[model samples]
Target: MATDPIHQFQISRIVPIEVGSLDVSFTNSSLFMVATVAAVTLFLVLATRGRGLVPTRLQSMAEISYEFVANMLRDAAGTEGMRFFPLVFSLFMFVLFANLFGMFPYFFTVMSHLIVTFALAMLVIGTVVIYGFMRHGLKFLGLFVPHGVPGYLIPLVTVIEIISFLSRPISLSIRLFANMLAGHITLKVFAGFVVSLSALGAVGIGGAILPLAMTIALTALEFLVAFLQAYVFAVLTCMYLNDAIHPGH
Candidate 1:
């Protein structure tokens, strides 16, 4: 079980709770999710609490994260999008912290679950839809109609647009889930190879060097991926929110 690559993704119940027919059990996944949120909250609070004229390392990191998301949102959705800064910032931080937490040994990756990522994607799309209609009324449907399509092609274009819009959540969710799942599984397999090889003999120990190096390299790459996935998710979210703000485009 220790060498099983798939074993690492298992979600064992930490505190089983049954509410009638529903199982509201708190599992390792739930614990890690709570940890992720708490970590992000605590980091932000502690990092900015001092707010010194000369910023500390934590303060600088916090400030840089703020500005990075701010700039990305602004560029994608313009100044009006700043109103959604809280949402965008929260999503970015939550995802980033969650991904980073998964890099630790024995940690359960919440984002590795399709359901979790799908739920988050739905939240973004749901916000865009609800806000779009509430803010623009029926005009929100204009998002599916292009600005300069010929009359005969409008129907075809509209249909395509609608399909594309509906697929957003699926694509968004799968992208994050698949990347994290695949990366971790690959890493686990390579590391398992190293362990199994080392156990064989003196000859086997030398044979383990390649897999060990690969394990180290993959570890570094996964860290990079953890950050990039969060960034991509945030950027795409900003683009989607832009449709809500300006449906004509």
Candidate 2:
């Protein structure tokens, strides 16, 4: 009976303030984005405010997070990328918070949408291009050439490399979007089954209990998925950065 996609992902005009032509409507999705950012900001700010010698729970969380991104950069991109740790860490935290916040019963899943994921992917690809060109000047285009390939195979390998490089955004965005969409839709379908069966008599209602339990279990599983998807996005982005930094391999 709930048409609102489990009655959770509702789109609404929150502020009701409209510009002359801009029509800047504040949506539920926008509100959830703000909440996610605010929550993350508070968490990091409070967690590391004093930098205690004896780590508190919040401080430990902050330290763990810092080490995660720092080690990721160190392992994947080496010392040169240490300078870029802030960028990478911010990206990971933002995406992670966005995905985790969406797992709440009524919160909006920002990364579930293709446009949001695509925009983030575009940012990653754009950064790679900019950094590559900045580091290598005009020679950055040499990235498309295969290093060990013979002279005759250079053309074919270059074409494949070009396709692979160009498809980075496509690959990155699709992974997040498809996973989120599928998880949410599958949950919704199970929820519908629970509701429909529970509406009938005692036997039918008892039958619905199985799906109800499954839905609850799946909801918990989805929480894990939300975090994993965000981490996957960040790790893949870092891997792409590695390619840009040391190309032709």
Candidate 3:
């Protein structure tokens, strides 16, 4: 299985646990998730521990990330959305670190899983719905009714809007999950090609060079994609939160 492109995505139980009929066994995916959280926590703690006037490299990074998300939220939802900063920031950092960690050999990419991404997308949508209703009550339904629409078209437009809103979570989750899954699989396939080709005689070694180079290029591209996906997720989240704050239009 060393050269199997799909083998890397396999989920294996690291610590199998059986609680009656329920299999809540801790798997490689679980381990990586915990690792991602721990890494983010450690980085933030260390980054802000000193609070120096002349910021350290870690502190600079932390500050930049903070400002980046802060500006994103502020611009999208205005100052009111800053209330959800912790949630947005946490999601961004978690996804980013998880994606970065997966770049390492043998690390499980939790973000590549549909269930995981769906859960996160649902969390954002849930927050929007819960907070929207809590703050605006029945009027929050105004989100489905566009302004200045003719009375006859209102019903049809409302139905369309409702459908579009409902699709948000599915699209959000699939976008992240699909991108990571496809990128990793492609990377693995190219890497596997390098290995399989190199295993042959001298001519095989020479031919392996192309795939090896491609693997390296794909590796760098994947890193860029990791950050972009996280950013897109966060930006979309801010826009959704804006809907909660201002449900009209």
Q: Tens digit of lDDT per residue, candidate 2, span 76-149? A: 88777776777788788888898888777667888777888898899989988999888877677888886778
**Displacement of the residue 47 alpha carbon in candidate 3, Å:** 0.8
Error of 3 at 117 (Å): 0.2
Candidate 1 minimal-lDDT segment of 10 residues: 2-11
Where does candidate 3 clash, by residue pair?
Answer: none
Q: Once superposed on the true structure, which residue ranges of model 2 sit more than 4 Å away at CA?
A: 1-11, 16-24
lDDT per residue for candidate 3 within 1-249, as digits (tens), equals 987877888889989999999999999999999999999999999999999999999999999999999999999999999999999999999999999998988887889999999999999999999999999999999999998999999999999999999999999999999999999999999999988898898999999999999999999999999999999999999999999999983
List all candidate RMSDs to the true structure. Answer: 1.1, 2.1, 1.1
- Clash pairs, model 1 backbone: none
Q: How far off is residue 226 in model 1, in Å?
A: 0.3
Compute each candidate's TM-score over C-alphas.
0.97, 0.91, 0.97
State the C-alpha lDDT per candidate: 0.96, 0.83, 0.95
> Candidate 1, TM-score vs. the true structure?
0.97
- Against the true structure, candidate 3 reaches a TM-score of 0.97
